[model samples]
Target chain A: MAKSTIKLRTKEKGGKIQVKALITHPMETGLRKDKKTGKKIPEHYITKVVVEANGKPVLTADWSGSISKNPFLSFSYAGSKDDTVKLTWTDNTGKSDSIEKKVGEK
Target chain B: MKRRSFLKGSIAAGAAGAGLAAGILTPNMAFADDVADNPFKAKSVDEVLKMLGASGAESSDKIKIKAPEIAENGAVVPVGITSEIPGTTEIISITAKNPTPLAARYTFGEGAVPAIKSRFKMGKTTDVIAVVKAGDKYYTAKKEVKVTKGGCGG
Candidate 1:
Protein backbone atom coordinates (compact mmCIF):
# COMPACT_ATOMS: atom_id res chain seq x y z
CA MET A 1 0.00 0.00 0.00
CA ALA A 2 2.59 2.51 1.03
CA LYS A 3 5.73 3.13 -0.98
CA SER A 4 7.91 0.01 -0.79
CA THR A 5 9.98 -0.63 2.29
CA ILE A 6 12.18 -3.01 0.27
CA LYS A 7 15.88 -2.39 -0.16
CA LEU A 8 17.53 -3.47 -3.43
CA ARG A 9 21.04 -3.78 -4.78
CA THR A 10 22.39 -4.88 -8.17
CA LYS A 11 25.95 -5.31 -9.29
CA GLU A 12 27.46 -6.45 -12.58
CA LYS A 13 30.78 -8.15 -13.17
CA GLY A 14 32.15 -10.37 -15.90
CA GLY A 15 28.92 -10.78 -17.86
CA LYS A 16 26.87 -11.53 -14.78
CA ILE A 17 24.82 -9.55 -12.29
CA GLN A 18 23.98 -10.22 -8.67
CA VAL A 19 20.76 -8.96 -7.13
CA LYS A 20 19.91 -8.74 -3.46
CA ALA A 21 16.76 -7.58 -1.73
CA LEU A 22 15.51 -7.32 1.82
CA ILE A 23 11.80 -7.08 2.53
CA THR A 24 10.59 -5.57 5.79
CA HIS A 25 7.48 -7.26 7.07
CA PRO A 26 6.12 -8.60 10.29
CA MET A 27 5.85 -12.14 8.81
CA GLU A 28 3.57 -13.08 11.63
CA THR A 29 2.81 -16.81 11.53
CA GLY A 30 -0.52 -16.59 13.42
CA LEU A 31 0.80 -19.19 15.78
CA ARG A 32 2.71 -16.83 17.98
CA LYS A 33 0.46 -15.35 20.60
CA ASP A 34 0.63 -11.96 22.19
CA LYS A 35 2.26 -12.26 25.57
CA LYS A 36 -0.39 -10.16 27.19
CA THR A 37 -3.49 -10.66 25.06
CA GLY A 38 -3.01 -14.39 24.84
CA LYS A 39 -4.43 -14.35 21.32
CA LYS A 40 -2.93 -15.77 18.13
CA ILE A 41 -1.17 -13.30 15.89
CA PRO A 42 -2.71 -13.30 12.43
CA GLU A 43 -0.65 -14.82 9.64
CA HIS A 44 1.02 -12.18 7.51
CA TYR A 45 4.03 -12.80 5.31
CA ILE A 46 5.33 -12.11 1.84
CA THR A 47 4.03 -14.98 -0.26
CA LYS A 48 5.80 -14.45 -3.57
CA VAL A 49 8.89 -12.55 -4.63
CA VAL A 50 9.42 -11.82 -8.32
CA VAL A 51 12.41 -10.21 -9.98
CA GLU A 52 12.58 -8.77 -13.47
CA ALA A 53 15.55 -7.43 -15.34
CA ASN A 54 15.19 -5.20 -18.39
CA GLY A 55 11.46 -5.91 -18.22
CA LYS A 56 11.99 -9.68 -18.53
CA PRO A 57 11.31 -12.26 -15.84
CA VAL A 58 14.44 -13.50 -14.10
CA LEU A 59 13.52 -15.12 -10.81
CA THR A 60 10.57 -15.90 -8.59
CA ALA A 61 10.48 -17.29 -5.06
CA ASP A 62 7.52 -18.59 -3.07
CA TRP A 63 7.55 -18.34 0.69
CA SER A 64 5.34 -18.84 3.70
CA GLY A 65 5.25 -18.10 7.40
CA SER A 66 8.43 -20.12 7.71
CA ILE A 67 10.37 -17.18 6.33
CA SER A 68 11.82 -14.95 9.00
CA LYS A 69 10.70 -11.45 9.65
CA ASN A 70 12.37 -9.01 7.29
CA PRO A 71 13.46 -11.68 4.82
CA PHE A 72 16.64 -11.29 2.79
CA LEU A 73 17.04 -12.70 -0.74
CA SER A 74 20.18 -12.74 -2.84
CA PHE A 75 20.78 -14.46 -6.15
CA SER A 76 22.54 -14.02 -9.46
CA TYR A 77 21.34 -13.57 -13.05
CA ALA A 78 23.01 -13.00 -16.37
CA GLY A 79 23.18 -9.34 -17.33
CA SER A 80 25.34 -6.29 -17.93
CA LYS A 81 26.00 -3.01 -16.17
CA ASP A 82 23.10 -1.10 -17.70
CA ASP A 83 20.41 -3.70 -17.09
CA THR A 84 17.62 -2.76 -14.70
CA VAL A 85 16.27 -5.09 -12.05
CA LYS A 86 12.83 -4.70 -10.51
CA LEU A 87 11.48 -6.68 -7.58
CA THR A 88 7.93 -7.06 -6.29
CA TRP A 89 6.40 -9.02 -3.45
CA THR A 90 2.83 -10.06 -2.64
CA ASP A 91 1.67 -11.10 0.77
CA ASN A 92 -1.09 -13.37 2.08
CA THR A 93 -3.37 -10.40 2.74
CA GLY A 94 -2.87 -9.12 -0.83
CA LYS A 95 -0.75 -6.16 0.27
CA SER A 96 2.22 -5.54 -2.01
CA ASP A 97 5.49 -3.62 -2.24
CA SER A 98 7.99 -3.15 -5.07
CA ILE A 99 11.28 -1.47 -5.91
CA GLU A 100 13.52 -1.27 -8.96
CA LYS A 101 17.13 -0.44 -9.70
CA LYS A 102 19.67 -0.60 -12.47
CA VAL A 103 22.80 -2.73 -12.37
CA GLY A 104 26.00 -1.05 -11.15
CA GLU A 105 23.99 1.01 -8.68
CA LYS A 106 25.83 1.86 -5.49
CA MET B 1 -2.64 -3.00 17.41
CA LYS B 2 0.08 -1.29 19.38
CA ARG B 3 2.63 -3.92 18.51
CA ARG B 4 1.76 -3.59 14.85
CA SER B 5 2.40 0.12 14.98
CA PHE B 6 5.78 -0.37 16.61
CA LEU B 7 6.74 -2.94 13.99
CA LYS B 8 5.56 -0.88 11.06
CA GLY B 9 6.98 2.36 12.40
CA SER B 10 10.39 0.89 12.90
CA ILE B 11 10.68 0.35 9.12
CA ALA B 12 12.43 3.61 8.36
CA ALA B 13 15.10 4.05 5.70
CA GLY B 14 17.78 1.33 5.73
CA ALA B 15 15.62 -0.90 7.88
CA ALA B 16 15.50 -3.47 5.10
CA GLY B 17 18.99 -4.71 5.89
CA ALA B 18 20.62 -1.51 4.54
CA GLY B 19 20.81 -2.54 0.88
CA LEU B 20 21.55 0.33 -1.48
CA ALA B 21 18.46 1.94 -2.97
CA ALA B 22 18.99 3.09 -6.52
CA GLY B 23 16.87 5.16 -8.88
CA ILE B 24 13.22 4.19 -8.71
CA LEU B 25 11.91 3.07 -12.07
CA THR B 26 8.64 4.66 -13.11
CA PRO B 27 5.58 2.39 -13.44
CA ASN B 28 7.52 -0.68 -12.31
CA MET B 29 5.57 -0.80 -9.06
CA ALA B 30 2.99 -3.32 -10.09
CA PHE B 31 2.14 -6.19 -7.75
CA ALA B 32 3.24 -9.69 -8.67
CA ASP B 33 0.99 -12.34 -10.23
CA ASP B 34 -1.42 -14.40 -8.14
CA VAL B 35 0.28 -15.36 -4.90
CA ALA B 36 0.93 -19.03 -4.36
CA ASP B 37 -0.66 -20.81 -1.46
CA ASN B 38 1.42 -20.81 1.71
CA PRO B 39 3.53 -23.96 2.16
CA PHE B 40 3.51 -23.87 5.97
CA LYS B 41 0.23 -25.73 6.27
CA ALA B 42 1.66 -29.15 5.50
CA LYS B 43 2.13 -31.14 8.67
CA SER B 44 5.31 -33.11 7.97
CA VAL B 45 8.22 -33.57 5.58
CA ASP B 46 6.60 -36.64 4.06
CA GLU B 47 3.39 -34.73 3.50
CA VAL B 48 5.32 -31.91 1.88
CA LEU B 49 6.94 -34.35 -0.53
CA LYS B 50 3.56 -35.90 -1.21
CA MET B 51 2.29 -32.47 -2.17
CA LEU B 52 5.03 -32.27 -4.80
CA GLY B 53 4.43 -35.87 -5.96
CA ALA B 54 8.08 -36.68 -5.13
CA SER B 55 9.11 -39.79 -3.27
CA GLY B 56 12.01 -42.10 -2.54
CA ALA B 57 14.35 -39.20 -2.08
CA GLU B 58 17.76 -40.61 -1.23
CA SER B 59 20.27 -38.99 1.07
CA SER B 60 23.18 -37.53 -0.83
CA ASP B 61 26.42 -35.81 0.04
CA LYS B 62 26.23 -33.46 -2.91
CA ILE B 63 23.46 -31.52 -1.24
CA LYS B 64 24.73 -29.29 1.55
CA ILE B 65 22.80 -27.20 4.06
CA LYS B 66 24.79 -24.43 5.66
CA ALA B 67 23.23 -23.38 8.95
CA PRO B 68 24.67 -22.26 12.23
CA GLU B 69 25.11 -24.66 15.13
CA ILE B 70 23.70 -22.13 17.57
CA ALA B 71 20.94 -19.80 16.44
CA GLU B 72 20.37 -17.01 18.93
CA ASN B 73 17.12 -16.03 17.29
CA GLY B 74 15.02 -19.03 16.45
CA ALA B 75 12.89 -16.76 14.27
CA VAL B 76 15.61 -15.82 11.80
CA VAL B 77 18.49 -18.17 11.12
CA PRO B 78 20.33 -17.62 7.86
CA VAL B 79 20.52 -20.90 5.97
CA GLY B 80 22.18 -21.67 2.66
CA ILE B 81 21.84 -24.70 0.43
CA THR B 82 23.87 -25.87 -2.53
CA SER B 83 23.66 -28.97 -4.68
CA GLU B 84 26.67 -29.92 -6.77
CA ILE B 85 24.80 -32.71 -8.48
CA PRO B 86 24.56 -32.36 -12.22
CA GLY B 87 21.19 -31.39 -13.65
CA THR B 88 19.94 -30.15 -10.30
CA THR B 89 16.89 -28.07 -11.12
CA GLU B 90 14.42 -27.87 -8.27
CA ILE B 91 15.21 -27.30 -4.60
CA ILE B 92 13.24 -27.15 -1.37
CA SER B 93 14.08 -26.64 2.32
CA ILE B 94 12.32 -28.59 5.01
CA THR B 95 12.39 -29.03 8.78
CA ALA B 96 11.95 -32.48 10.20
CA LYS B 97 9.79 -31.64 13.21
CA ASN B 98 8.21 -28.24 12.84
CA PRO B 99 4.49 -27.66 12.62
CA THR B 100 5.02 -27.62 8.86
CA PRO B 101 8.29 -29.04 7.67
CA LEU B 102 8.57 -27.45 4.24
CA ALA B 103 10.02 -23.93 4.42
CA ALA B 104 10.67 -22.87 0.82
CA ARG B 105 11.08 -24.02 -2.80
CA TYR B 106 12.83 -22.81 -5.94
CA THR B 107 13.00 -23.86 -9.59
CA PHE B 108 16.20 -23.02 -11.40
CA GLY B 109 16.24 -21.70 -14.92
CA GLU B 110 18.76 -22.00 -17.72
CA GLY B 111 22.26 -21.07 -16.60
CA ALA B 112 21.08 -20.73 -13.04
CA VAL B 113 23.14 -22.19 -10.23
CA PRO B 114 21.83 -25.04 -8.11
CA ALA B 115 22.00 -23.03 -4.90
CA ILE B 116 19.77 -20.99 -2.62
CA LYS B 117 20.23 -18.99 0.54
CA SER B 118 17.47 -17.67 2.75
CA ARG B 119 16.54 -17.18 6.38
CA PHE B 120 14.26 -19.69 8.06
CA LYS B 121 12.42 -19.76 11.39
CA MET B 122 13.10 -22.82 13.49
CA GLY B 123 10.36 -23.77 15.91
CA LYS B 124 12.94 -25.61 17.92
CA THR B 125 16.21 -27.47 17.50
CA THR B 126 15.55 -29.72 14.51
CA ASP B 127 17.09 -31.14 11.38
CA VAL B 128 16.80 -28.78 8.45
CA ILE B 129 16.73 -30.78 5.26
CA ALA B 130 17.76 -29.42 1.90
CA VAL B 131 16.35 -31.43 -1.00
CA VAL B 132 17.36 -31.12 -4.62
CA LYS B 133 15.61 -32.54 -7.64
CA ALA B 134 17.96 -33.67 -10.35
CA GLY B 135 16.46 -35.16 -13.45
CA ASP B 136 13.62 -37.43 -12.29
CA LYS B 137 14.95 -38.26 -8.85
CA TYR B 138 15.29 -36.40 -5.56
CA TYR B 139 18.27 -36.13 -3.23
CA THR B 140 18.48 -34.68 0.27
CA ALA B 141 20.96 -33.52 2.92
CA LYS B 142 20.29 -32.17 6.39
CA LYS B 143 21.89 -30.30 9.29
CA GLU B 144 20.81 -29.98 12.89
CA VAL B 145 20.51 -26.47 14.27
CA LYS B 146 20.05 -25.79 17.93
CA VAL B 147 17.65 -22.87 18.33
CA THR B 148 17.65 -21.08 21.63
CA LYS B 149 14.05 -20.06 22.01
CA GLY B 150 13.19 -16.68 23.53
CA GLY B 151 16.87 -15.85 23.60
CA CYS B 152 17.07 -17.23 27.09
CA GLY B 153 20.66 -18.42 26.93
CA GLY B 154 23.11 -15.76 27.96
Candidate 2:
Protein backbone atom coordinates (compact mmCIF):
# COMPACT_ATOMS: atom_id res chain seq x y z
CA MET A 1 0.00 0.00 0.00
CA ALA A 2 1.15 3.51 -0.78
CA LYS A 3 1.87 5.88 2.06
CA SER A 4 -0.99 8.28 2.73
CA THR A 5 -0.38 11.87 1.65
CA ILE A 6 -2.82 13.28 4.15
CA LYS A 7 -2.27 13.81 7.88
CA LEU A 8 -5.54 14.30 9.74
CA ARG A 9 -6.51 14.81 13.36
CA THR A 10 -9.90 15.19 14.97
CA LYS A 11 -10.92 15.95 18.52
CA GLU A 12 -14.36 16.14 20.12
CA LYS A 13 -14.59 19.00 22.56
CA GLY A 14 -17.64 20.76 23.95
CA GLY A 15 -19.94 18.84 21.64
CA LYS A 16 -17.99 20.07 18.62
CA ILE A 17 -15.45 18.24 16.51
CA GLN A 18 -12.32 20.14 15.55
CA VAL A 19 -10.66 18.82 12.42
CA LYS A 20 -7.20 19.75 11.18
CA ALA A 21 -5.52 18.34 8.11
CA LEU A 22 -2.21 18.74 6.34
CA ILE A 23 -1.90 17.50 2.78
CA THR A 24 1.44 16.93 1.08
CA HIS A 25 1.44 18.39 -2.43
CA PRO A 26 3.61 20.51 -4.62
CA MET A 27 0.82 22.89 -5.73
CA GLU A 28 2.74 24.03 -8.77
CA THR A 29 1.37 27.25 -10.29
CA GLY A 30 2.74 26.64 -13.82
CA LEU A 31 4.32 30.12 -13.82
CA ARG A 32 7.40 29.12 -11.90
CA LYS A 33 10.44 28.16 -13.95
CA ASP A 34 12.88 25.51 -12.95
CA LYS A 35 16.09 27.17 -11.81
CA LYS A 36 18.25 24.68 -13.68
CA THR A 37 16.02 23.73 -16.62
CA GLY A 38 14.72 27.24 -17.35
CA LYS A 39 11.35 25.75 -18.19
CA LYS A 40 7.95 26.53 -16.76
CA ILE A 41 6.45 23.81 -14.62
CA PRO A 42 3.08 22.48 -15.58
CA GLU A 43 0.18 23.59 -13.42
CA HIS A 44 -0.69 21.04 -10.79
CA TYR A 45 -2.86 21.61 -7.74
CA ILE A 46 -5.71 20.21 -5.73
CA THR A 47 -9.07 21.34 -7.11
CA LYS A 48 -11.46 20.09 -4.48
CA VAL A 49 -11.54 18.72 -0.96
CA VAL A 50 -14.51 17.15 0.78
CA VAL A 51 -14.92 16.37 4.47
CA GLU A 52 -17.70 14.06 5.51
CA ALA A 53 -19.03 13.16 8.91
CA ASN A 54 -20.88 9.90 9.34
CA GLY A 55 -21.00 9.47 5.56
CA LYS A 56 -22.57 12.92 5.04
CA PRO A 57 -20.57 15.85 3.77
CA VAL A 58 -19.97 18.56 6.38
CA LEU A 59 -17.59 20.73 4.40
CA THR A 60 -16.38 21.13 0.83
CA ALA A 61 -13.59 23.37 -0.48
CA ASP A 62 -12.41 24.48 -3.90
CA TRP A 63 -8.75 25.38 -4.03
CA SER A 64 -6.28 26.89 -6.48
CA GLY A 65 -2.52 26.88 -6.90
CA SER A 66 -2.32 30.07 -4.87
CA ILE A 67 -2.79 27.94 -1.78
CA SER A 68 0.56 27.23 -0.15
CA LYS A 69 2.46 24.06 -0.89
CA ASN A 70 1.53 21.29 1.52
CA PRO A 71 -1.66 23.07 2.51
CA PHE A 72 -2.95 23.10 6.06
CA LEU A 73 -6.66 23.30 6.80
CA SER A 74 -8.61 23.54 10.05
CA PHE A 75 -12.31 23.74 10.77
CA SER A 76 -14.90 22.64 13.30
CA TYR A 77 -18.25 20.92 13.04
CA ALA A 78 -20.97 20.02 15.50
CA GLY A 79 -20.83 16.29 16.03
CA SER A 80 -20.37 13.71 18.71
CA LYS A 81 -17.56 11.31 19.41
CA ASP A 82 -17.27 7.95 17.58
CA ASP A 83 -18.66 9.42 14.36
CA THR A 84 -16.86 8.49 11.18
CA VAL A 85 -14.97 11.33 9.52
CA LYS A 86 -13.48 11.14 6.07
CA LEU A 87 -11.31 13.59 4.16
CA THR A 88 -10.70 13.36 0.44
CA TRP A 89 -8.89 15.56 -2.06
CA THR A 90 -8.68 15.50 -5.86
CA ASP A 91 -6.00 17.23 -7.85
CA ASN A 92 -6.08 18.64 -11.37
CA THR A 93 -4.12 15.76 -12.87
CA GLY A 94 -6.80 13.24 -11.81
CA LYS A 95 -4.68 12.13 -8.83
CA SER A 96 -6.58 11.76 -5.59
CA ASP A 97 -6.23 10.55 -2.02
CA SER A 98 -8.46 10.02 0.98
CA ILE A 99 -8.26 9.10 4.65
CA GLU A 100 -10.91 8.05 7.13
CA LYS A 101 -10.87 8.11 10.92
CA LYS A 102 -13.27 7.87 13.79
CA VAL A 103 -13.87 11.04 15.81
CA GLY A 104 -11.92 11.31 19.07
CA GLU A 105 -9.68 8.37 18.22
CA LYS A 106 -6.37 9.72 16.89
CA MET B 1 -18.99 -11.82 -36.81
CA LYS B 2 -20.45 -8.60 -38.24
CA ARG B 3 -23.64 -8.99 -36.20
CA ARG B 4 -21.67 -9.57 -33.02
CA SER B 5 -19.60 -6.39 -33.56
CA PHE B 6 -22.76 -4.33 -34.26
CA LEU B 7 -24.41 -5.53 -31.06
CA LYS B 8 -21.25 -4.68 -29.03
CA GLY B 9 -21.19 -1.17 -30.47
CA SER B 10 -24.84 -0.60 -29.54
CA ILE B 11 -24.21 -1.80 -25.98
CA ALA B 12 -21.26 0.56 -25.58
CA ALA B 13 -23.30 3.50 -26.82
CA GLY B 14 -26.09 2.69 -24.41
CA ALA B 15 -23.67 2.55 -21.51
CA ALA B 16 -22.21 5.93 -22.44
CA GLY B 17 -25.67 7.50 -22.59
CA ALA B 18 -26.49 6.19 -19.14
CA GLY B 19 -23.23 7.56 -17.77
CA LEU B 20 -23.99 10.98 -19.22
CA ALA B 21 -27.40 11.00 -17.58
CA ALA B 22 -25.92 10.04 -14.24
CA GLY B 23 -23.31 12.78 -14.47
CA ILE B 24 -25.99 15.37 -15.01
CA LEU B 25 -28.08 14.15 -12.08
CA THR B 26 -25.23 14.10 -9.54
CA PRO B 27 -24.66 17.37 -7.64
CA ASN B 28 -20.95 16.67 -7.28
CA MET B 29 -20.62 16.26 -11.02
CA ALA B 30 -22.35 19.62 -11.57
CA PHE B 31 -19.94 21.21 -9.09
CA ALA B 32 -17.01 19.73 -10.97
CA ASP B 33 -18.24 21.33 -14.18
CA ASP B 34 -18.61 24.67 -12.42
CA VAL B 35 -15.06 24.48 -11.09
CA ALA B 36 -13.76 23.69 -14.54
CA ASP B 37 -15.57 26.66 -16.03
CA ASN B 38 -14.76 29.66 -13.82
CA PRO B 39 -13.40 31.43 -10.68
CA PHE B 40 -10.04 29.69 -10.18
CA LYS B 41 -8.68 30.95 -13.48
CA ALA B 42 -10.00 34.47 -12.94
CA LYS B 43 -7.27 37.07 -12.54
CA SER B 44 -9.11 39.50 -10.31
CA VAL B 45 -11.19 39.24 -7.17
CA ASP B 46 -14.06 41.11 -8.82
CA GLU B 47 -14.14 38.61 -11.66
CA VAL B 48 -14.13 35.72 -9.22
CA LEU B 49 -17.01 37.28 -7.25
CA LYS B 50 -18.96 37.77 -10.45
CA MET B 51 -18.47 34.15 -11.39
CA LEU B 52 -19.69 33.19 -7.92
CA GLY B 53 -22.87 35.29 -8.38
CA ALA B 54 -21.73 37.65 -5.63
CA SER B 55 -21.11 40.99 -7.27
CA GLY B 56 -21.33 44.21 -5.24
CA ALA B 57 -20.82 42.49 -1.93
CA GLU B 58 -21.29 44.72 1.10
CA SER B 59 -18.53 45.39 3.60
CA SER B 60 -19.32 43.96 7.01
CA ASP B 61 -17.77 44.15 10.45
CA LYS B 62 -19.21 40.83 11.43
CA ILE B 63 -16.56 39.08 9.41
CA LYS B 64 -13.12 38.91 11.00
CA ILE B 65 -9.88 37.99 9.28
CA LYS B 66 -6.86 37.02 11.37
CA ALA B 67 -3.48 37.23 9.71
CA PRO B 68 -0.09 38.71 10.33
CA GLU B 69 0.37 42.36 9.45
CA ILE B 70 3.70 41.50 7.87
CA ALA B 71 4.96 38.13 6.72
CA GLU B 72 8.67 37.41 6.62
CA ASN B 73 8.16 34.50 4.26
CA GLY B 74 5.61 34.84 1.50
CA ALA B 75 5.78 31.17 0.69
CA VAL B 76 3.47 30.36 3.59
CA VAL B 77 1.17 32.84 5.27
CA PRO B 78 -1.27 31.63 7.87
CA VAL B 79 -4.78 33.08 7.67
CA GLY B 80 -8.04 32.54 9.41
CA ILE B 81 -11.62 33.70 8.81
CA THR B 82 -14.58 33.83 11.15
CA SER B 83 -18.07 34.80 10.07
CA GLU B 84 -20.59 35.78 12.70
CA ILE B 85 -23.43 36.19 10.25
CA PRO B 86 -26.24 33.69 10.55
CA GLY B 87 -26.81 31.20 7.75
CA THR B 88 -23.39 31.66 6.24
CA THR B 89 -23.22 29.01 3.59
CA GLU B 90 -19.87 29.89 2.01
CA ILE B 91 -16.56 31.64 2.67
CA ILE B 92 -14.00 32.69 0.08
CA SER B 93 -10.44 33.94 0.49
CA ILE B 94 -8.70 36.14 -2.03
CA THR B 95 -5.21 37.60 -2.29
CA ALA B 96 -5.61 40.81 -4.25
CA LYS B 97 -2.08 41.01 -5.63
CA ASN B 98 -1.62 37.40 -6.65
CA PRO B 99 -1.79 36.61 -10.35
CA THR B 100 -4.82 34.49 -9.58
CA PRO B 101 -6.56 36.33 -6.78
CA LEU B 102 -9.06 33.65 -5.85
CA ALA B 103 -7.31 31.46 -3.35
CA ALA B 104 -9.91 29.19 -1.83
CA ARG B 105 -13.67 28.84 -1.40
CA TYR B 106 -15.24 26.78 1.36
CA THR B 107 -18.84 25.64 1.67
CA PHE B 108 -20.36 24.65 4.97
CA GLY B 109 -23.19 22.22 5.45
CA GLU B 110 -25.49 21.62 8.37
CA GLY B 111 -23.67 20.94 11.68
CA ALA B 112 -20.62 22.82 10.44
CA VAL B 113 -18.99 25.97 11.75
CA PRO B 114 -18.46 29.12 9.72
CA ALA B 115 -14.81 29.52 10.64
CA ILE B 116 -11.79 28.28 8.73
CA LYS B 117 -8.01 28.44 8.98
CA SER B 118 -5.66 27.78 6.12
CA ARG B 119 -2.44 28.82 4.43
CA PHE B 120 -1.88 30.58 1.09
CA LYS B 121 0.93 31.99 -1.01
CA MET B 122 1.42 35.67 -1.73
CA GLY B 123 3.45 37.05 -4.59
CA LYS B 124 3.74 40.37 -2.80
CA THR B 125 2.04 42.68 -0.37
CA THR B 126 -1.72 42.45 -0.87
CA ASP B 127 -5.11 42.81 0.69
CA VAL B 128 -6.55 39.53 1.89
CA ILE B 129 -10.29 39.61 1.49
CA ALA B 130 -12.73 37.25 3.12
CA VAL B 131 -16.16 37.02 1.57
CA VAL B 132 -19.03 35.45 3.43
CA LYS B 133 -22.27 34.39 1.81
CA ALA B 134 -25.36 34.30 4.01
CA GLY B 135 -28.90 33.76 2.84
CA ASP B 136 -28.38 35.18 -0.66
CA LYS B 137 -26.39 38.21 0.51
CA TYR B 138 -22.62 38.58 0.47
CA TYR B 139 -20.53 40.29 3.13
CA THR B 140 -16.80 40.88 3.15
CA ALA B 141 -13.85 41.89 5.34
CA LYS B 142 -10.40 42.93 4.26
CA LYS B 143 -6.96 42.84 5.88
CA GLU B 144 -3.64 43.97 4.49
CA VAL B 145 -0.75 41.52 4.65
CA LYS B 146 2.64 42.83 3.67
CA VAL B 147 5.03 40.25 2.29
CA THR B 148 8.74 40.90 2.66
CA LYS B 149 9.51 38.35 -0.05
CA GLY B 150 7.55 37.18 -3.06
CA GLY B 151 6.46 33.58 -3.34
CA CYS B 152 5.61 32.94 -7.01
CA GLY B 153 9.03 32.37 -8.47
CA GLY B 154 11.55 29.60 -7.89
My TM-score estimates for the predictions, one after another, are 0.79, 0.86
Q: What is the C-alpha interface RMSD of model 1?
A: 3.7
Weakest lDDT window of 10 consecutive positions for candidate 1 chain B: B29-38
Off by over 4 Å in 2: B1-37
CAPRI band for model 2: medium
lDDT of 2 by residue, A1-106 (tens): 9889999999999999999999999999888999999778999999999999999999999999999999999999999997899999999999999999998666
The most accurate candidate by TM-score is 2
DockQ of each: 0.24, 0.69
What tens-digit string does per-residue lDDT give for candidate 2 at B61-112? Answer: 9999999999988989999999999999999999998999999999998999
Model 1, TM vs. native: 0.79
Question: Each model: TM-score of chain B?
Answer: 0.70, 0.77
User: Which residues of candidate 1, in runs, are more than 4 Å off?
Assistant: A1-3, B1-39, B150-154
- What local lDDT does model 1 show for residue B137? 93
The deviation in Å at residue B73 for candidate 2 is 0.8
The count of residue-pair clashes in candidate 2 stands at 0
Q: Calculate the i-RMS of every candidate, to one decimal place.
A: 3.7, 0.6
True contacts kept of 1: 0.45
